[model samples]
Target: MSHVSGDLVRRYANGDKGIPADQVWALEAHMETCASCRQLLASHADGIAPLLDTVWAGLTPAEVPAKRRRLSTWITPAGFPWIGMTILIAAIAMLLDALTVLDTSFVLLVAPVAPMLGVALAWNKNADPMYELVAGSPRAGLELVLRRTVGVLVVMIPALFLAGLPGRVSPALWLLPSLAFTVGALVLGLLIGVTRASVVLAGVWLLVVAGPSLAEQNVPAVLHPASLPYWALIIVGCVAVLGLRADSFSRLLR
Candidate 1:
């Protein structure tokens, strides 16, 4: 195969002249096998050379986004299934309470802790396939965490309301505790893994609060009206810790 003329390559590179279609095709094909001619073309490109390089540079992997097609800047597709499962569990708990199969006290026992599981799932590496992408985003960490947490509560609190209807469990009984537990889990999550932190808190609630409440058929003291002030204090304190440690969420464990 013959090499492209220096004149043709320069013309093509610089938009100085338009070559005939047939010759342009042959010249391009020839350049594929002719590194010397390719170099010669680039040398003749002059002022247009840098523009060509810039265009090519933009096509490289380095120029591409680290992550792609994330569902939202904050939440990911991985969160949906977990949130749905949490709601389903809440609905089942409601049904059980309605049937009186589990005592109303037992229903109340799990209500505050149920949403924490969803929050854990929202950001946990094990639960989210895109955890790295979600957590490493520029808007990751506290802002992203808070958005997903809000999503969990938006879906969860309403479900709890419907479920608690049959049991006559007051919203006041569970709401502040739910928020407090979620914030506390997040605060602890900054040190330990979020999944582990949430699991630990939930397990503690089950063993210390739920089990005893169920066995004795009474509301746990923590869920009582007089305890509301302490829950409020927990909420304020955890929020401050979360804000202080916001950057930690951006660099989550792989």
Candidate 2:
């Protein structure tokens, strides 16, 4: 049996758990000569597992969006390109409704533009010349734009409801008009880009879609397929791609 005067060596080798003070010096001397034991200790190192990995019961999943996109974000932002203007327009609409200058219902028009133009200009700005070459490229453009449109809508929706609350317009009336108007603006914005070159985007859209649609006081005329609601609804249908996967944009860029 190994024996030692140093307490440390006695403790380590014989399970003494304690040893004389003189044995401490003997233990140090033994350790200096023991290359094998030193290497064994080094291999054990700190003997600790990484807390984050080892303690976790399971790994968290990764996904493109952690949460479903909020429609509110699209509401107000879609109505205007500039955040300031987007914010400003919603504020003005609310104010106009409050002061009796305009119907609280005007908030509807402001909501859609944030999404339509906001998405359009953003897509146009980022547009690689190659976007048009591939099939389904427009879908990608639509998704990116639509996501942005949703952001605008999110803010505008609440502002709209609050603005109308004071005016005694039923909530349903405000919401339907906003929805109808958003549908209208989105279509008008997309279509007028094809029409008069002399006109700016919004001005042309305003003259063609908003002006005409509102002029048709009859709900049936407003809903007419040749008119704003029809076109707006169609454009909204096209923009439904927002909720879909973005693989199309990647392919289009390719």
Candidate 3:
């Protein structure tokens, strides 16, 4: 691969706005794979060393500890509450199922979208206070998004599994749909924001599947064993698209 020109590296390191967006993107993307170019960029970035030092100098000794409590890049603090809420909702659904309060299995109905609550907040601009700084970083594209999404799934998948135990539903019935919706949100998020994409997909599922399933007191065909393959196909397709458009998340607009 051709290395980026020194002038472009200097301008990028200096935060020059005159450079076109595409060039800036290409340069950053290239730097991720090119150690020599990254070293060159680091050298150019030395010009900002004094500014950084000045900012650090302005901080008082008393305030240093507070500043050190930096947020995790994988998942925002706001995501915890949403994750908690999802778990609580799943428990409630399980309770409803055990009590025979609803003819349709509430556990299965809620399983697919349970992780969505956490996923939506995973990279939400509003939920994350450090959105600008995090999104502007060189590694802030698909990798960061996937990290946060995995963090959510790690917690949610087990919770959903246990919650559905009482309903005796096949794991595939809920697991595949959950995976599909989660990745589908990310795929659509390349066009809309993740938060909006999550909401839109969840809303559609509730309307088209959950609502009808509850109203008719029957499990939706989409959630049946026969539909697992289709859900798997959707997941594969969404993942492929996400890989192709991975750069989209790096933009501030996303």
Candidate 4:
């Protein structure tokens, strides 16, 4: 496993607040999953031992418990609003479908990209105010990314299912595509960052599928049953790429 530099750990443990925030964030994030680095941090902690003891003594049992309840590693509070927005968008699409406002399947068009918005927000630095702390947690790498992705899927899949109930679109048409796009975002995210990757994928979907479908007043051929195998292939390929680049998620910038 990659480890933090010894000099950086020593500076951090010596209470050197002058360290750049990005470097600090990276170090903390790396140490969370690296036992050897954690040990290195402990070795350098003697310099700050007295301060730690004093602070520890100042905290009362009641005050300790008064801290906010720990959130699940699967999802952060920052992701909740985006998830709700995604559900709202699905509901709106369903409404449009029910009212026959659009000739094409609006529900199907929206379903595949719905969960992606939430996945983008899941670990985004700009979206999550507590990103530093979250990144510094023990679950900061691909495990954390997968957990948050699962969390997004858990809420979005049900919402999409209910939304599609009012439309003629079959779940498989949208479901496989949704999973494919979500995992594809992660695969691309290893290089470009999750938020940008998601935006690019969504934009491409709108241009290639949703736009043409609406203009033709018909669901695109890609959303047809025959295309399910292609979507499945994309998902499998993205999953394999994600597995190979798993370590990329440990960095602060991503």
lDDT of 4 by residue, 1-254 (tens): 66788888889988798999999998888988988899989998886788888898878454445669776767767787898889999999999989877767788999999898889986688888877886777778888889889998998998899998877678878899999999998888777888999999999999998998999898789988999999999999999998888877877865
Error of 2 at 248 (Å): 5.0
Which residue ranges in model 1 land beyond 4 Å of their true spot? 1-74, 101-103
If scored against the real structure, what TM-score would every candidate get? 0.72, 0.40, 0.71, 0.73
Model 3's number of clashes is: 0
lDDT of 3 at 165: 89
Maximum-TM-score candidate: 4
> Which residue pairs come into collision in candidate 1?
none
Rate residue 33 of model 3 by lDDT. Answer: 95
- 1-254 per-residue lDDT for model 3 (tens digits): 89999988888887899999999889889999999998998788778889888898888465435456766656666788888989999999988889986657898998898887789877788888878897899878888889999999999999988988888866778899999999998888777888899889999999998998898998899988998999999999999999998888888746
Candidate 1 lDDT by residue in tens digits, 1-254: 56777677778887655678888888888888889998988787688867879998888758556777645534456777887887787888777777665444545777898889889976688877778776767877778788888878888889888878877888888999999999999988887888999999999998998888878777778888999999999999999988887888889753
lDDT of each: 0.81, 0.46, 0.86, 0.86
Predicted candidate 2 versus true structure: per-residue lDDT over 127-222, tens digit per residue = 323334422445454455456556655655666566546555444433443454454444443434311211254565467655654465322333
Comparing 2 and 3 on TM-score, the stronger one:
3
| Residue 177 error, candidate 2, Å | 6.8
